[model samples]
Target: LAKTTQPISMDSYEGQEVNITCSHNNIATNDYITWYQQFPSQGPRFIIQGYKTKVTNEVASLFIPADRKSSTLSLPRVSLSDTAVYYCLVVKQAGTALIFGKGTTLSVSS
Candidate 1:
């Protein structure tokens, strides 16, 4: 598991692009995209897990780049409906229980 550093809170206006970057040292090759989301009182839900590339879904876009030590989760056109608690997790190369970043709170307003 790698120690991660990221912002704890972010504010964005409606239809604004928000980029939250999490940097971890010594991320493994198979570490993949380590992004997750947790709603209300539910458990952390896996959102994206990818390699050193760019992956995009209907919700957000993730970029691992070629550095392998950092990743950026991009939310396009965020709205008040998108406010939630999102976090980054780095699964170990051995595929065992691992670590996560101090979650981030994304607040969107009109």
Candidate 2:
């Protein structure tokens, strides 16, 4: 598994966009980048994913560079409800196990 690096905390304002980046310097070729969001007392939920280039869902967008060493999760027009710990993970194509790391806490204030 590739070790990921992310900011410990980030601050943003309501209705603003937030982009949290995670670095995986040793990412494997078969690995995919997955982003998960967790609230105070809840388990992480799948937010977005991508193998390369860009991927977008209703909640967020994930952008992966060609080298696959890093990825960014983009939240458009975020709100207070979007404040949570965002986790970036590198996983095998068919793997189900998730190893959580110290995630990036996004603080969205009014």
Candidate 3:
């Protein structure tokens, strides 16, 4: 099974766009790649999911390449309030407890 890996931290200025990438070299056929954002002391909120190509929503855009070995999450025109930890997980279905690693902490400054 492919496990996901992301950076431990990232820094960005307010009003700037940010992109975080994760690598999942061994992603399984039945697994779906999901991204989540979490604020301090709060549970993670789903950002996007994709098996291939791209998926976009109100908060972010997810881009997956053909090899399925990596994916990127793009946050546009970020604000200071957007500072949070981002997680990428590969799972078989929704509502499952994601096996989390140390997530990437995004710091947005004004």
Candidate 4:
């Protein structure tokens, strides 16, 4: 599995757009970049994923550059409820248990 590096923390206000970038220089061709958010005392939940270019879903958007060395998870108009620890993971196979790095703690204030 590829190692992931992300910020230790971030701050944002309600209604602001938050972008967290993760770096995975050893990412393999078959690897997919996936982002998950975990609230305190809860399991991490999938937010978005992308192999290349961009992928968007109801909760968030994943942007992967051509090199696939780094990616960004974008949260739009974030609210206090969005405050959580966000994880960036490199997944190469399905049904594999999620491997987590020290996540980026996002603080959203009103």
Candidate 5:
């Protein structure tokens, strides 16, 4: 599995756009970059995913560079309800349990 590094915390006002970048210097070719968002008590929900280039959904957009060493997740018009922890993970097709470390906590204020 590939290791990812992200910020510990971020602050943003309500109705603002937020972008969180994660670094994965040793990503494997079969690895896919996946982003998850978690609220206080709930388990993390899938946000977006991509192997390379860009991928976008209703919730967020994932951008990956050619080297595949890093990716950026962009959230548009974030609100207070969006305040949560965001995690970046690299997973291969093989079945394996995800080991989550401390994620980036997004604090949305008014």
Candidate 6:
């Protein structure tokens, strides 16, 4: 697995957009970028994923540059309820066990 780099924490106000960036300089060609959001004492939930370019769903958008060395997870108009730890994972292949590192802590204020 590739190691990811992210901010230890971030702060935002309600109705604000939050963008968290993660870097994986050693990412493999077959690796895909995946983002997950985890609340207190709960399992992480998949937010978005992509191999290159961009991918968007109802909850968030994932942007990957051509180099594929880094990715950004964009959340639009976040609320207090959106506060959580966000993780960026590099999945090299299917059936790989999920390994997690300390994720970015996002605090959304009212």
Candidate 6 local lDDT, 29-104, one digit each (tens)? 9899999999999989999889999999999999999999999999999999999999999997683677688999
- Indicate the TM-score of model 2: 0.97
Q: Which portions of model 4 miss their true places by more than 4 Å? A: none
Q: What is the lDDT of residue 52 in candidate 6?
A: 99
| lDDT: worst 10-residue window of model 4 | 90-99
Which consecutive 10 residues in model 1 have the weakest lDDT in total? 92-101
* CA lDDT scores, all candidates in order: 0.82, 0.93, 0.89, 0.94, 0.92, 0.93
The CA lDDT at 81 in model 4 is: 98
Tens-digit lDDT string for candidate 2 (20-74): 9999999999999999999998989999889999999899999999999999999
- Estimate the TM-score of every prediction: 0.88, 0.97, 0.93, 0.96, 0.95, 0.96
TM-score of 3: 0.93
Residue lDDT tens for model 5, 1-110 = 88999999999999898999999999998999988999988989988889999999989999999999999999999999999999999888673877576889999999
In model 2, what is the error at residue 78, expressed in angstroms? 0.4
Identify the leading candidate in terms of TM-score: 2
User: Model 1 residue 70 lDDT?
Assistant: 88
* Residue pairs whose backbone atoms clash in candidate 4: none
Q: After superposition, how far is residue 41 of candidate 4 from its true place, in Å?
A: 1.4
After superposing all C-alphas onto the true structure, candidate 6 shows an RMSD in angstroms of 0.8
Ten contiguous residues with the weakest lDDT in model 2: 91-100
> In model 5, what are the clashing residue pairs, if there are any?
none
